[model samples]
Structure formats: C-alpha cells, structure tokens
Target: MGVDNNSISVSLEKLERFIAAALRRAGLPEADAATVAGLMAQADLQGSDGHGIIRLPQYIRRIRSGGINVRPDIRVVADMPGMAIVDGDNGMGHLVVSRATELAIDKARTQGAAWVGTRRSNHAGPASLYSAMPLRHDMVGIYFAVGNANHLPPWGGTDMLLSTNPISVGVPAGDEPPVVLDMATTVAAYGKVKAKAKRGEMMPEGWMIDREGRPLLDPTRSDEGFLMPIGGHKGYGLALIVGLLAGTLNGAAMGRDVVDFNKDHVTPTNTGQAMLVLNLAAFGPVGGFKEAVDRLVGDLRGSARMPGTDRIWIPGEQSHARRQRYRETGIPVSRGVAAELDQLARELEIPPLA
Candidate 1:
C-alpha cells in the first residue's frame, strides 16, 4: 500500500493513527501520543498542512536526541486570580499548550477572562489549534507564540533577531462558523518557504530578501536571505511585542535565545506560548453576542467583489470550506511530504502513511 509519486490523499483516521504510532515509537506515552496526534490531524483538516503531521520527523528527531522531554512533569508555577504561568518541562508543545488553554478556559468561565502562559514547551502546531479551543464553550480565544526560530531582523538592521511571531484569534458566531484569524507578522511564514523548497518550487519575489535587500525568490536559497516583514517596521513592532508577551513574560526562549528547531534537534528550544480566554457572558448575553457576530459575518461576505474577484470571505470562511471538503474527500499530501513521512515511518518501524 503505497501512494502515487505525484501526491497522496490520506484519510483523517489513517493520518491520525500513523502519527500516534510514530509518536509512541518515539517514546511518547500512549495518551500523550493520541492527544498530539488528534490536534495535529485537526490542523491538517483545517488546511494548515505546513504545521500538521509534516512536522513529525523533526519532532521525532528532537525526541530521540533528548531535545524534548518524553516524561514531562508539566505544572503550574505561578497562580493568580485571572492569570497563571505553567512550566512545560520541555514537553511536546501540543501537550503543553493544550493544557494551558484548558486552564485558561476554566478560569475564564468563573472570572470572566483568564490569561495563561507556558514556558519550556516545544513547537506546537498551528496557532489556530489553541485559539479555536474555546469556541466550543462560546468563548473568544486569543493565542500568541514566539516562533521556534529567528528568520527576520529588526526593521532596518541586518542582524537576524526576530521570529515570525504569530497570533490567532477565534470568535464564535450564532449560526455561522467561528471566525478564526491566524497570521504571522511577516509577509510569509518560514514554514511556507520550507514547504515550497520541499516541493522544488520558487517562492514569490516579496517573500524574502537578500542581505543587500534584493528580492530573493528561490526557496532553496533561504539561508542566503531573510524573510520580509508585512509592513516593514509595523510588522517588526508586532513581532517584537508578541515575543515579549509570549516569550520574555513567560521566561522562555526569545530573540538570541531561540534555537532553530529545524536545524538543531538537540537543544531545548524552551518555546513560549500564551492563550487568553474571554467569556462572552461576562460582558453580556452570549446568545446576543454570537447573533451579532453572525450578522457581521454575513455583512462582510455579502459585500460586492472587485473586477476579478469571485466572492468575499471572512477570516475563517475558506478554512471552514476546506475542512468540509477534506472531511468528505481526503487531505492531499504532496509527494515530497509523503516520501519524508514514509521514510520516517520506516525508521521508526511503524506503518507508513499512504
């Protein structure tokens, strides 16, 4: 049972099982493996292919090399009425952040809002995973993270000192799908560049720039250039602020302390992440608020399009459609990614994903 060389369409169940098995083989406990696998699979279902199971090989490598703790004693180190800090003990990021998000949601249910931070965690999947966690409870979720590696520099300076530093917010609606916004401060995320390189594709001109500030379109030459920020100094400022809140405030890796997890698998990245949960009932009636959101979303989507545009879409509209399509059909995996996963399966003596 192998897939074609061009691409592979994997069922959600198969993908989740394969990932869980791989994680178990990599020494993660069964429950922990299942938790991580489910979250990563949800990421893929939501169209975040770059942050889904594609990261398994790197995570497994880090685990095997002792970069991540397999048996982590994750615990809350500081506690307050509406805020708390957790130490992940260098555990898998998905596990750490999932726990943190749950804590935030529980606290917010009672206190109206709660903020939770995690330190000594690994690279979790997409930011949307954590941000969307509160949607089931009719709460708004905000998530931020210090990226696992530095790929950009200060607005004008040449030194690479800033990561993409992503953020996500998920707001529930009455009858519409939740509005989820997930974005990096940069023009493009470094993972997209890596995905392009894996597919042997050229990047868009604006994605990166060389030291001389020349457009660099070749993804293979990413090392020779730095990722460009979205709005020059503005994006740089956003990244800096996110890093401070998610990294410095949590006593986790940031700036010069961030280790390139893709390159170095042995060092503990101590990645920092934060989640804030806001209870809708805290401000007013949850039902009224959600209905208002639904109306707002409808208004946005009903707007007329420009000359070449087809239709207008809110933040999570396309992703919700993609998730539906993937659920009905299957998640498409590029040949390169499938091959890498196959190799990883073989190395771990687990069933291959096809």
Candidate 2:
C-alpha cells in the first residue's frame, strides 16, 4: 500500500483546530485545550508525525477515563533562581511543560541559564517545541524526556525496562534554520514500529530484533521483540543515562512502573523530564554564536554525499522544510487517523472534523 505523496503535507492551522476542538469536547477549558492542541499540531509541522495529531485519540481516551486531569492546577512544587521542579497535578504534559519552559526562559533571562524539571507530567508530544523556546531570546535550548511508555529491555533482559527516551536540541543560527536535532535513542522510535505494524509493512533491517538476537523486521510480531539501540551497547548506555536524569532525578516513574498509555488509560503517568536553557549572551554575543551555527550547518551540507544520494541533509533540515510546507497546507491525518479521531469525537459527543 502506498500513500499519495501529493496529499502528505498537512495544513498546520487545520490540524490545530481539530485537536483543539477535540480537547474542548473532552472537557478541557478552551484556552488550555487550544494551547496543547497548537503544540501538538506544531509537532507534525516539525516532522514529528508520531508525536503530533497521531496522539489525539490516546489523549482523549486518557481524559475520558479519568487518567489525565482536564482542569489541572499545575504549579511549582520546588523553585530556585536557576532550577525548579513542577507538579503537573496530573494535568496534560503540554500545559505542564509550557509552564516549565516559560519559567526556564524567564529565569534564564536573569541567570544567563536555567534548568527545569517536571514530575507527573503526561505525554507532551515532541520535545523540540520546549527546546526551541529560548531561541526567541537568542538562547540555546535542550530537552530530554522519559517516554510515557517503555518499550525497550535492558541489554540482557527480556522485560520491557526503558523508554525510547528522546532528546531534542535547538540552536539558533544567523540567516539559517536553527539546528534542531530531535531523535530517539533507539535506532527507530516506537512510533515507527506502530506505523509499520498498522500499514502491514515490514521494517527495515536494524529497527528491531528478537530476544534470541535475530533480526525482527516483521512489525506484526513486534510484541515478541524489542527496539534496537542506535549503536548497539553505546546507544543503550545513553538511553539508560537519559532515564536516570529525566526519570529518576525528577522523582517520577521509572523501571517497571511506566504505564503504557496506549494499553491502559486510567493510570497517572507520573512521567519525569528535564531541560536546560542556555542564554547565548552567557557565552558571547548572540550574533557571533548564530553565525558560527550557520557556518556549522553550511560545513555539514558541503560534505560529499554518498553514491546514489541526492544531497547532504542536515539533522533538522527535513523537519524545517516540513514545517514550512505544512504551515501552507493542512496536515494529513491519513484515513486511519481520521477514523480514529472521528470515533473519539463520537465518544465525547463533540462534533467531528470534516
């Protein structure tokens, strides 16, 4: 099965509208729902389709099942000049993180940098949005998170022990797209596996393997396997470190406690995560750093492409292009996603999207 390439890029505004409407019907206040919906839509614009509108149905399910709080009174449980810990009050991750990012940016403006962590934050879509906040003020932003669901086992264990645990870094560059690199520590994100499984497509080599060490590309049998780390043991190490910092350090769920939001929607995720914002002026002039970043991107693109390659693409180039195009055309929800969203709207008694 193949999708029409011409229909792939979705209009960003429409996507936000759909999500916002859905959340309101699910009982979230209009303003809070719109804020989260807008962020989710922007995730798709940035090429994080798995983290974007694809999560709408799950979010709805969580809210209806009393898992996620619709009117959470998010607040800071701990605070300092350069650091703080947030209590999401079982609210949506989008609201919790937006608050944390704002707090970080405000404090960074005064301290030249700041770090913020959040506990009890639910799934917040992609990490890039939060990481890109400081760019408006000429600051570099970095974010990491404990995946709401765990899909990987320890190097030698069969028990699902860890999350894909993504990391996103955004660095502003003069006259060039900010160098934003958002990637899962796993060779392939768990979403890719789900997509493949849904489409009845086999995954490419190295995406996963059975516990016995044989390649497992048949996504249909994914439950019997685990995701492969990016570079074998090295990637596994990084995932472990991220789990510690983003999960354990934040005093949130870890190890066997991570509830699979997809499988069960009634449990409080208690997801933990942390981010650091670095003011460019803290190191030097913002202009100089941006120029250096531009040069850095230029240098990478100037490198020779491999045989059969079209052009050298930077880490965030594809996402940047997607953002521009999707901002023009509404994001494509695919026939399957649309059907799911429609079903959710019915359950909530909300008017469905066209």
Candidate 3:
C-alpha cells in the first residue's frame, strides 16, 4: 500500500538502526539499545504507530533526566517452578518485559505453563509485542500491563484512579496467522491520543470526554479529559482486574501510586507487566491444536457478513497483512513524527532517520 502524501516511507532496517544509534548516544549499552530498538521497530512494522518511533523522544528525555536506569540490574527477585517475579531496577520497559517473557517461555518449556511478572519497568509499547513471542515456540502467550499514565477513571467517577490497562493474547495456528488480540481496556489507549495530537488530528467523539462530561474531540486538549473505558463499566472492571494482576499482585505501582510518566519525566514509574505462556503440547498435540485453530480461523473468515461488510477478519489478520505490506513498501511515518525524530537526532548529534 502507498503511504499518504503527508508521510514518509522508510525501510525497517533504517528505522531500527536510527533508533538504536539515538538510544546508544543517550546512554543505553549497545546490546540494550539494539534490543529495545528492534522491538520498537517491530511495533511500527505491525502498524502500531502510537507505540513505535513516536516514543523515542520521550524515552530519550527520560533517560537524560535520569528517570530511567541505563544499566539496570534486571533480575528475578522471586522464583518458583511455575512462576517468577522480576525486578527491572527502573530500566526500559522493553528490556524488562523481554527478560520476563524469556523466563516465562523457558519455564513453560518444562513446566507446561509459566507466569512471569515484572516491577520497576517503564512503558513497554504494545502488549502484543511480548505476547506474540511465544507463538514461535508453539505456545499460547498472554500478556498484561498497567499503562504508565493514568488516563482513565473508575466507572461513574471523574477521579483518574485507573489507567488504560491492556491485555494481549497470542495463539499459534497451523496455516493461518496467529490469533493475536491486543487492546486497551479503554475505548482508546492514551498513546493513540498522543499520536493524534502529534499528527494534528482530532479524536473521535467516543474516545474521551471532558471534566464536564462533554465529548473531547480535540486531541490537543486530551489532558482536560479522561479516556473512556470500553463497554462502559465492564471495561472499567477489566482495567481494574488487569491492573491488579499486572501491578498490585507484583507489588508494583497501581491506582494513585502510579506516576504520570508523561508529565513527571524525573520520577520512576515502577510500571508492572505480566507474561503467561502455556505449552500447547501439554494440552494436546501441538500440531493438532494448531490445525484446530486454523480450521476455526477459516470458518470465521468464511462466515456470512452483514450487508455492507465486504469480508470478515480474524484478530491480528490486519496487522499480519500490515507486516507483509510494510516489508514490501516500507513503513509509513507521518511527517510530524518524522520531523520530531529529526529534531531529536539533531539534539543527540546523531544521523537523522530519513
């Protein structure tokens, strides 16, 4: 697909290298910079525009402000046969969650299932990034995270006590793309609001509302309102449950204890996340499980659709297609985002992304 006129298309290789270079200049070790950069680029590759290179400037700011530890001693604080708790030491979220997910996958290989949780991590982009990791090993991956900033209120209240806590699940398939579902418990993630503000675009009416309960369509005025939960009170409930699992249960920050990462770049957020991996072989034959998943996926896609609907889509299919298309046509970065990245590169005295 062709990129819009207001955007620039760049190869994934260039994007990853630029991110890594900028991060390295900011203080992260070469290996850590490369690891975080690769995941950030993969977010863009999967069309997660809000969580990709758009976050580089913020991360750099935090790093420079000493809010993030460049050389964190990420280690498992508590360990059991089927579970573990990792302390990130205020490190970058990508690196923290990657270590936890790796531990989860390793344990699941022998234990049939494993749950790994992290504390003192930072924003880790989209949840699907980690959840999808287990798919390569023919294991189902489930991930949860407490958003770095609290943009959500409890049901029927104006207090920003909750966040756009997210959940992601990845199920491996035989012939079909993995069934990956990644979503915020809110109607929209705050990252999307940030993305819209950067692009100078208005948000849809339902994403948020002002303190007076009026619709908030202007992304630039996002702070004046709070994000709305999906499915009304039900989404609020889910967000709370997710926060308890990913945050409170792990002894990480939650509720009022959560730091506003966007405004308070100097304070550690103590962000929390959890990764659960289930070995398919333990449930049954891995191949059989995958085949059944493929069959169900085909059935869903071929099912009848509503009058105006052209086709039915399985979860993650669109992102899968985006990944394939991006490989061929390059990833699209809005000019606004590109300009900011260029400015950051100038400040870092590194090569520009273009």
Candidate 4:
C-alpha cells in the first residue's frame, strides 16, 4: 500500500486487517479484535472520520494499560420482555453495543419494541453505527451515549459538567436511502476538535469559549476553554437529559466522573450507552410504512430551493453519498493520522496501514 497524490487511500479489507492485528497485539482475542475492526472500518466507510481508525491508537493504548477488558463477559444484569440492562464488563464499546443492539432487535421482533442499556463500555464509534443497525431488520433504531469525556457545562455556568452526549436515530425507507440523524449536543464533537488540533487547523469561533466566555478559535487552546452547546441553554438541557438517560439510568460514569480517555489510558471509562428499537410491523405493514417514509423524504427533498442553493438533502443523504464515493475510491486517511498509525504498527510489530 502506498500514498497516491499525497493522500493515503485504504481498502476496507486492509484497514480491518491492520486494526485487528493492532488489537490482537494489544491483547484482544482474535475474534473480538476482528469484530471491532469490522465495525470501525464500517464507521470509516460511512464517513465517520473522527470515530473510525482515528481512535485505534488510543484504544490500543488503553488496552495495553489495562483500562479495557479484552475478554469481556457482557451479560444482561436485568431482563424484561421489552427491556434489558447489560453489563459490558469494561469491554470495548463496539462489542458491547453490538451485542446490546442485537439483543434489542431480537426483543423488538418479539415484543414490538425494545430498549437496552449498557455500562462499563469504552468509547464506541459514531452513534450512527448502532442507530443504523436496525435498518436491516426494517425497524427504526435510536441510540444515545454519554461521551467518554466532559467538554461542556450547564448554561450560564463554567463547571464543565456535561459531555457531548450524542444521539442518533435511523429510520428505514422504501425507495430512498434510510434517514439517519447523528449529532453531538455541542457545537462540535470533541473528537472533531482533537482532529483539527492534530491537523494543525484552527477551530471556528462558535466551537468553544474561554473561561471568560470569549470565543476560542485555536485548537491547541482547547483545554483552556470548553465546547459550546449547540443552542446555548437548549442544547445544554438536551445534553443533560441524554447524560441522565444514558449514564445515570445505566449506573455508569457521568458528569465529573467521566475520565478523559484521550488524556488517561489507565482508567476504565465505564461509559454508558443506550439503544432502542421499534418494529415497523408493530404499527402497520412494513412495506406501507416504508413507502410512506419514502414519500415524506421525497416531498422534503423536492421542495423549492433558495437562491444559490443546489438541492435539498435529507438527514442521511450526504452520508449515503459519501459512503458510495468512498467505497469506489477508497477511504482517505490524513497524513497525521497515517503517521500515528504507522508508529503504532511499528510498536506492535504489525504491518503499517500505508
């Protein structure tokens, strides 16, 4: 593998193999490592640049430092007909959430709807990864997570008590691509800020604010400020609700207890995440519902556009387009991320990603 025109284009197969090898070197079982690698590669394929292989080095560092459990016995601590609570046993979040989403889909198939929560999980990839899981089953999926680190505070306060607290929802459609909305409660995800810093790019003014509430545009000064909520008080409220539901409800770390996984590699994050599945068949014929969704999506996209606008887009439309382009052209890896991964491969005695 080699860089082409200063951009490293990686095939999904090669990316998965490289990630699995790194994880195996970090003590993860082969099966578990491969499972996670596939999910991370899928994230990258879907244009989730921040949550994909970009986080591999950090995950491997945590695993080597005993912060993550390689062979976790993820099990349901409490079970009901339509709901369940899982203990991830401090395993990789991709594994834990995958299991949880599967369980939710299974339960939803039988009970019309299902909700599953997990604790003791590490940082999972993008929220869309789990939220989109149920689309294949003709069911809608919703996912929420308390971010691994706190980057925002309550409105009118500077206490830094809230994480990005992302939420995502995926809805199946008939003719149109599935509609998926994935977003952080903040103006920007902390991972995006970190990525900008790594690339030596400046942050936008609205992304963060300093202690005195001045706009902070320098990515390197991220620690000197805190992320801004999307809509000031409203986004702060949403973040609070998400944290409470994903963290407090699941008996996992939240607020001040969140460990900055980017800074500390030795502490188990004990992250909390929740997923819900709704069976479309429960309401009506799946085909009819999907057709209705397609109609709605079409109506939205067909609306008149303002001046200088090309066209309208549904929530997941851009991601779907990006996925197709990336699949055809290969995923692009930034130079900085490529270098870091190369260094990691050398340390683990595995082949470099190139």
Mark the regions of model 2 whose C-alpha exceeds 4 Å error after superposition.
Answer: 1-10
* Model 1 agreement with the true structure over 29-124: per-residue lDDT tens digits: 999999999999988898888788888898999999999999999999999989999999999999999999999999999999999999999899
lDDT of 3 at 104: 99
Cα-based TM-score, every candidate: 0.98, 0.94, 0.99, 0.98
lDDT over C-alpha atoms for residue 164 of model 1 = 93
Give RMSD to native, each candidate.
1.3, 2.3, 1.1, 1.1
lDDT of 1: 0.92
Which structure among the candidates has the greatest lDDT?
A: 3
lDDT per residue as tens, model 3, 109-162 = 999999999999999999999999999999999999999999999998999999
Largest TM-score belongs to which candidate?
3
Candidate 4, residues 267-316, lDDT tens digits: the string is 99999999999999899999999899999998999999999989999998
Positional deviation of 45 in candidate 2, in angstroms?
A: 1.6
Q: Write the per-residue lDDT of candidate 2 for residues 1-354, one digit (tens) a residue.
A: 124632343466667777898899889999998999889988877767678887888888889899999999899988999999988999999999999888988889889889899999898888888888878889888898888778788777778899899888988889988888888889988877766665557899889989898999898888788898778788888888988888888888888888898789999999987888998888988888888888988888888888998888877778889777766665665666666777877877776654
Cα deviation of 204, candidate 1, in Å: 1.3
| Deviating ranges (above 4 Å) for candidate 3 | 1-4
TM-score of candidate 4 versus the correct structure, residues matched by position: 0.98
